[model samples]
Structure formats: C-alpha cells, structure tokens
Target: MTRNFNYWSQKGVKGPSPSPMFGNILSYFITPRPHLNMQWQKLYGKIYGVYNGNKPVLMVAEPELIKQICVKDFHIFSDRNTNRRIHPILSKHLVVETGDDWKRIRSIVTPTFSSSKMKKMYPMIRQCLDDFIVELDVYAKDKGDVNVKIMYGNYTMDVISRCAFATKTNSHKDPNDPFIINAQKVFAPKVSRALCFMLLPTFVLKAFNMRGIAEESANEFFFNITRHVMKTRSNSQKKYNDFIELLMNAQKSSTNNNTKDVNHYDENDSSEAHHVNEGEEEKQVENKILSSVDKYITEEEILAQSWVFFVAGYETTATTLTFASYELALNQDSQQRLYEEEEKQAENKILSSVDKYITEEEILAQSWVFFVAGYETTATTLTFASYELALNQDSQQRLYEEVMTAVDSKGEIDYDILARLPYLDAVISETLRLHSPAIILIRQASEDYKLGDTGITLKKGQQLEIPIYAVHHNEEFYEKPNDFIPNRFLPENRHNIKPYSYIPFGAGPRNCIGMRFALMEAKLALAQVIKRYRFFRSPNTDVPLLLNKSTILHSPKRINYPFGAGPRNCIGMRFGLMEAKLALAQVIRRYRFFQTPNTDVPLQLNVSLAIRTPKRVIIGIEKRL
Candidate 1:
C-alpha cells in the first residue's frame, strides 16, 4: 500500500507525503479530517488523494462530481468499502450489505418506517420523553449537576425498546437491567474495535465464540429473552400495535414460506443441478434469495437485530441532548426570550416514505437501520443547535419570538405551529450543518469513474472519503463559513447555496432513511426547550468552545453543512430528529439549565468519531420560575 502512494501521484493524484505506520494520521493529529482534506485540495486541486491507514482515498468536494457518483453512477459505486462479507448477524445487517441483497432487503423493510408506522410509535416516544422530564425535574429541584447525556441515552433506549422491540423499562432507574448492561457491552468501543481486527476474521471469531466482537453472555441472554417473548406472544390472544407485532407477522410468513419452498422444490424437480441452463439457474437463485428473506427472520435473526437496534439508539441520542444542555446553559438571554415568547405551537408531519409486508428478518433489520441512522445524529444536531444558540443570541432570540408568536395564535405546539416557526427550523438546520453527526462518508468503486473536467479517474477497487467537516466549513460554499449564523439557511439565502454543499442528512436516494424523522425530533425538542428555560453563562461556562483536539480559530472552509450526501445517506434521519426534538421540548418547558461546578465549558469534543460530543457536559438545573 505504501508503494502505491507514488503510483497514485504519477497518475495525477496529488496528496500529502505519507510517512511510515502513521501515514497521514499525523496530519489528522494536526487537524480534523475535513480541514486536512480542504488543505490538500488547495495544494493539489479539488480532486486529490491521501493515504488513510494503508489505502489511498480519493477526496472530492466539488458538487457536480459528487452528483455524478452518488446519483448518476450509483450502480458502479453501489457498495461501501467497509461492507465486508462477514459471518455474524451483523453482516446480514443492511448497513454493510451491497448490491442485490441490499436492494431486496431495503424494499421489504421500507414500509415499517412509513409515516403511519411512526405515528403508531409516537405515543411510545412521548411516554419516554415524559418519563425523562420527571427525572430532570427532580434534578432541578435538588440543584444537581445533571449529566444530560446519560439521561437522554436512557430515555432514547427506553423509547426504542418499547416502539422497536415491544419492551418498557426505565433504564436510568435500574442500570444493571439486562437490556442496559448488555447493550453497553455490545456497543462498547472494545467490541467495535475487536470486530475490526484483521487477525480475527469473521468465521474464526464466530467459530471460536469470541465475545470480543459481541459479548457472548449478553448475546445469549438476549436470545433467550427473545425466544420466551415470542413464545408468550404466540399464545396471547391480544394483538399489539408495536414493532414486535409487525415483525411477528414476518416471522409467520417466513415459517409458511420455508414449508412451501421445501415441499414445492421437491415435487417440481427430479434433479437439482445438471439439467438447468444458466438463465434457469439464475431464476432459481433469485427465487431462493427471496425465499430466504422469510426463512431468515426467525427467532435468532430477531434477537440479533434487536441488539443492533439497542446498540445504535442507546448512546447517540443521549450524547446530543447533553450538548444541547450545555449550549442552553451558556446563552441565557436567548434562553430567557425563548421562555417568554414560546409558551407555544406545532405538530410534526414529515414528507415521503418505507416497505412492503416484509419478512421478519427484513423488518428487524429495517428497525436496526432506523435506530442506527436516526438516534445519535439527531442528538448531535440538538447539541450543536444548543451550542450555536448559546454562541449566537440574536438568532436564538428570533427563533424564540417566532415560536412564541406561532404558539400564541395556535394551541400547544404541533406540526402546524412548527411550520410557521421558520427561524426555529433554520436554527436546527444551521446546527446540523455545523455539527453533523456522521463524520466521514465513504464509498467503494466497482468500476473506474472520472472526475468532472479534471480528467483524473478513480480506478475500480479504490475508495473515496468525503471530508464532511471541511465542506461544511468551506468558504467556497458559505460566506463566513465558521460563524454560527442561522440566516444562511433562511428561505431567501438557501437557494444560493451550492448543490450538495449542505447535506446534513446527506443527499440522493440512498441518503439517510430517517432524515425527516430526525428533523421533526430536533425541531420539536428545541421549540419546547426554547420556550421554558433561560440558559445563562456560569462560572463553569467556557467561551468559544473547544473540541477534544486543538481549537482551530481560523477555519479555511465554508460555514455549516453536515451529515453526508449520496446514495448511502443515513436511513433513520427523521425518526432520530423527532425523538430529539420532543425530548428537548418536554424538558425545556419544565426546568431551567445552568452551568455547574462540574460543567466543562469550551468542551473538548471526542474526535474518535464524526459527532462532536463533549467528554462530559454536566449541567446544573433549576425549575423555571
């Protein structure tokens, strides 16, 4: 791989000089990936290459080229480079699946996320948020330093478990509950790191029953619990309206399908192989794959996907809320105005689409997709929105007034009132642009593709990395790219922004499936919070926040713009947003947040992943008087 660095340079792929085991990591140590990518673009033009690990990754931010690859040439770059064909149930999970299997599974699972389904799940989410508020209220009365991240995480996990898995337990009250404990173990960084170990291949890891990739004890407990749950459901006379019911239907269909396939195949064929032509053989294979969809969504598959859902939803939502709490604490005037004006309006209504009467496995997989794509990113946006609001008071005040007016005219906030609060929406949009949850977007090439006008081609088997932070902060796309300005996304200024320059939930068909859900969640949460409490700077508050790494005072790129764009954007974007917005709304209306002795102002963000979460954002609380 080191040998190919010069080879790429000869082919007009100009980038940084790689050094030893560090490769370009030292440059990342200097700055974030996006900033470094933007710098490289200036040195070697827009279309360039840089070494990440042992591979040379193409980094391009120009819109037209992005459009061609993500929209037009999607088929050639249909799969993600990280999509290895591993053995675990994780491999069967859609996030990493490529080509036909991906398409097939996607089709089946799409319906479970439809507006109607989300509507059914809304009550559960609301219940979770309500429970969350109760806890916050206690903290406010006690004047305790609230660790909102942990609180929000527990809240989100409860909601996902209820709506997605048909279980309800207060995770915060009983931290040792199997659901909470195993979830931590399964999604722990060590487990994730273990999964990435090249030495422990998927089959070997599975064969040896290594708990490193997935905690064996936790996995077994969950599997047993699921089996029992299913058995109880089978005997129960009452029907349920949650995800469990939807998946159980799929399980029934799968059971019926396996029986039919076994019987039909035997009676219809004398010989299985020698007599068939290539075309006939292809048809058989296709039919078998479809049959397997039903066949696989069994008890084992259901349990596997439930873990996926738990792992994805648990932390991401909690972390984002924590950040928002911090931001609200720092910007008291804006918080005060929001409290005065927004005693107010709006329900959330999202546009467009998800699935057929999909199989049990497919439905379960889709739920996982919803959780993974939706939760953390939405939470991060809420965090950033709070941060920016604290930093930029005028925008926060404007949004607060708008929310107040809408609520004054209408009843309690619902989607209708939310529609009138454009400034509020704008604030959320700006936050997403600046602190998009997903960090780097990646794609693999199945065929060689060309860069627009540059004539430099990306070869088959090559990978491309889009530096989200760089593009979002690039001066070319946004004026005063580093500033926290919500007006940039106002209707008048929105159209002037370059195409693909502002993808918070990404762009294209393969973009985040849950985009609208996340948006709805964030808007609602912010609206409620803005109206109830005044967030003011305290002794613990730090001015001009800092990421975990060094603070780059003068960023070279455009302003705002986050999430990713393209065929493989986050799938559960809307769902996550909805949860975040609602949760924030409920808490803000009831209590005021303040900086505490424990509050770490000018937060040091964790640079390990894309989301800019603080190592800790402990905040003080007071019941709004």
Candidate 2:
C-alpha cells in the first residue's frame, strides 16, 4: 500500500522520506564509518545533513566552508566537541575547552611553545635521541626483527616527557611507566569510539567509565608529575628557561596581583599608604610590585594544561615514529638516497671538523629532523611512500637519484642543501597529499555562524569537522587520486594544485604550528634510510593499505612505514625522524634489507589506534660491504 506524501515544498525545497531504522543501523555497522559522511556529501551535496539518533549534524566538505569554520569563524567554532564520557580525561583540558576560558588559557600557554623557547629546549631533545640511537644499536646487535612502531612510541614518549614536563619519564627504559601506559589505554580507539560522548546521550556512557583503566590513576599520575615539577621550580633559588619555569612565574605573578579579595586589599592598601611617607617607602613598594595585573591560572589549571601537553605531545609523536620505520622497511631506494645525502653532508669540508664527529650543532640539526618528521604526515608519508615504492620501484629509484645528487653537491646534509632537493621534497609532499595523518579536524561552534553561498546558519554548540581524507581523495582536485604518484608534487604540477585543496596540516591561524619541524624530520629520516638500505615487497605486508578505523589519525591496519602529519601536530616529530634516519643509516651502512620467502604480501591488518602487523614484519637482513 503506497501512502501519498507531499515531497516538494514551495521554493523547490525537496525532502526525502525518513530512511528505515534498520538501514541506518546497517549503514552504521558495515560502512567505513569515517567515510560515511563523505559518502553522504556526494549524495546530498556539499553541505548535507544527518542525524545521529535525534541530534542534527551537518557535514561540510567544501574547502571554503572548512576554512570559515576553522579560521574566519574560529570564535564560533573554537571548542572541540569532545565526548566527556569517552574522553573524560581530556574534558577539563585546553583542547576541549570553549569561549573566553580557552582564549585566556591559550594566551597564557602560547609563550611556552614559542620558537625561541623550543630552540632552548633542543639540547634536551638531543639527549633523548642519543638514548634512542643506543637502544636501536642494542636491538640491531641482537639480530632480532624489532617492531619499529613500538620502539618509536617509546622514543617519543621519553623525549616529550623530558622536554615538555621537565621530568624524567624514562619511558624508553621503563616501558611500563604508569603515565605512559595509562595514557595509551586512554586513547585506545575501540573503547573510546564505542563511548561516543559527543552525542547528547554521552552522560549515559559515564557509568561504563568505571570499567576501563581507572581514570583516577591516570589523573593522579599526570598531576603528581606536574606538582613535583611545580614545587621544585617554586622553591629553587635558580631560574631555568623551561616550560615549567614559564608556567610557574606566570602563576605566581597572577596570584600576587589578584585584587579580588576586598578585605585583604583594604588592609594592604592602608599599610602601603601609611609607609609611603619617606623615599624608602616608594622603593619598598617598587620592590614588592607583582609581575601581572590580573589573576588567572590556578593550581588546577596548571595541572590540567600540563597533563594535556603530555598526552598531546607523547602518543601522537610515538605513533608517527612507529609508522616511519615501517615505511623505511618498504621503500629501500628512498631510504638509500636519504642515507647517501646524510653521508655527503657529513663529509662536507665546509662544516666544522667537530661537526663531522657529531657536534652539538649536528645533533641539534639532526634531532630536529627526527622530532619534526617523527609523527604526523612524515611517518604516514614514509608508510605510503614505501607502499608505493614497493608497488612502483621505478619512481623510488628516480627519487633516490635526485636526493643523492642534491646532497652530493654540498658534501653534507645541511638545511640549505636539503631544501634544494626538489624531487625529494616532491616525494614528501605527494605522500602527505594522499595519506594525511588526522583525517578530520573537529571543532565546536561557540556562537552562531554562517557558511558558504547557501548561507546556512550554524547554531551555537554545533560540531564542525573538516574531512581532510575526503578532501585529499577528491577526484576533482587530484587525478587518479587513489594512485601513489610522487611526480604530482613536482614543481611543474604543484602550481596547478588549488588552494585549500591540500590541508594535511590544515590552514590559517589554527593550522599546525609544527609543520616546518615535521617536514624537516621526515626529509632527514628518509634521506638517511635511503642512503644505507634498500626495500622490496614483503609477502607479509598488506598489498592494499587497510586503515585502522578506530583512530583519529588515519593509522594503518598493518605494519607500515613513515609517520603522520599536521600542526598542533606532533612536537616530537623532529626527534622521531632523526631516530629513524640514524637507525636506518647505521643498519643500512652495515647491511641490506631484502624480502624473504617468509615475508607475506597482501597481509591482513589489525585496525586499532595505531597500525600494527598481525604477525612480525618478517624480512631477511644481510650484511653489506
């Protein structure tokens, strides 16, 4: 029996009948959930709408619309629509906060990550990298096929913990550090994804939070570390230029200058005036003057921000580094070329004699490569680049030649020399274009806003997401968009690319702050690996890359190479990349990598927060003269 329904309204407004409940459920379970919105975009037009239960959601794919939400209308969409039930740990932190509170916190914390401060912290970063290299040497000497992914995570965790928190987390040495372990448990996608706290019903899931890793333990671990750092800084007579010092000073100044207490102020005000009869009174007042005009950050705020920094800085960098090694294993030619470049740079007579033997400057420069490229797109690029190289050896060899030539001219791998390697840069750019790390950048509307020519009004509290994976894969923007072709990033073709079409790190004020760092790290790592070793198709590797649907970052389902990309991206990207480069260089300089009979191609992938091989990435390693 057909029931007649009026489908069209007065102004050509068309509405389809409600979809069957079963169909919706089936769609949720079977389809790649991440791509579901993108699929809808194709069917319902760019600004299509959907309902997660009764909640209305609008998915925007048009670059301009995305830009407006993230940048132009940033005030309207500054909060991240974080699921409190699923991500209770991050609920009170800066990443999920909104409105004036976010602004104030960001203002106070921004100075901690300024370029000048980061430069000062480079020495500490180098120390972490040195430890990583020693660890790698131990692994290599054992002649055991190490899971590069796990090792990479350990390296980044150690670096970020020490550099950002000014604490000796020592995750590399103590793999079971409660903070590191609990932090990983917190982001486990399977558990977090199922808890979908963004929907209004998020409160219902809070009951289940008791079952997983105890939230208190994680919270305590983070807070204790922060409190220790804070107490040490506050009591110390000496001053240091670390992030902790900045926060401590800011907190003290804010607290002292606070005039909110009426009674206390009245008493202090009278005492000050009474003592101002002599010149000595003015001097005394001047000496007692506070640094700030207002009170803002509380102990809780400091602890919360510090916790966010650790969580944000560590896991992301670790994941990227893990993926980077996977890519190096697959792309031998690219790896060899990079290594040759490093060799050339090291041999350059222009550099100080001390630099040839790993001077602090050399370590700093090399370490930056690791930290910047360790995670985000660099690691993912390495993975995808290797996947393509393994599939298309011709392109891999061509890129190798370009890197080799570029490095040879300088006789060493200098920043300026590396920059001139167009083809190498192209290879890196192409990898980022295809396999961006974070597929979606989500923000919540803080106030009412309009988007695009449609003039659609987004109400306050609405969730905004920029589907980066969809944008990168859009056929209109890229020809044979699915195919891996490094040449697309070449100078001749790069100009043809449209603005905003490529946003691996996003764009504008909110774009990734760590982009330069990530890129440099990836280049150096890739350069070093390519110079020393060669890669071939491993039978153990999955032929077509399978993505781990659970992660925010587009992690692979199997062991893959390279790191991921973005700004507000990974802070340890430079450190991770350098580790990969150095490890690959040392190993490749001594041995060659080859596919073994035991190696599997078209291998199955285990999808999770980070990509992992179902089994070992079994390959034969042979010593080379």
- Provide the clashing-pair count of each candidate structure: 68, 64
Q: Write the per-residue lDDT of candidate 1 for residues 210-306, one digit (tens) a residue.
A: 5345556755555555555667888787876665565666556643543433211111111111001113332343344344442334343444444
Candidate 2 structure quality by residue, lDDT tens digits, 235-271: 6888656545656655655435533321111111111
Off by over 4 Å in 1: 25-46, 142-145, 191-231, 234-240, 249-308, 323-360, 367-371, 397-412, 415-420, 542-563, 591-601, 618-622
Which segments of candidate 2 are over 4 A away from where they belong?
A: 1-45, 82-89, 135-146, 169-173, 189-214, 237-246, 249-296, 318-428, 490-493, 514-533, 560-625
The candidate that achieves the highest TM-score relative to the unseen native structure:
1
The stretch of ten residues in a row with the least summed lDDT in candidate 2 is 353-362
Query: Which candidate ranks first by lDDT, i.e. highest?
Result: 1
Cα RMSD (angstroms) for every candidate in the order listed: 9.9, 12.8
Against the true structure, candidate 2 reaches a TM-score of 0.70
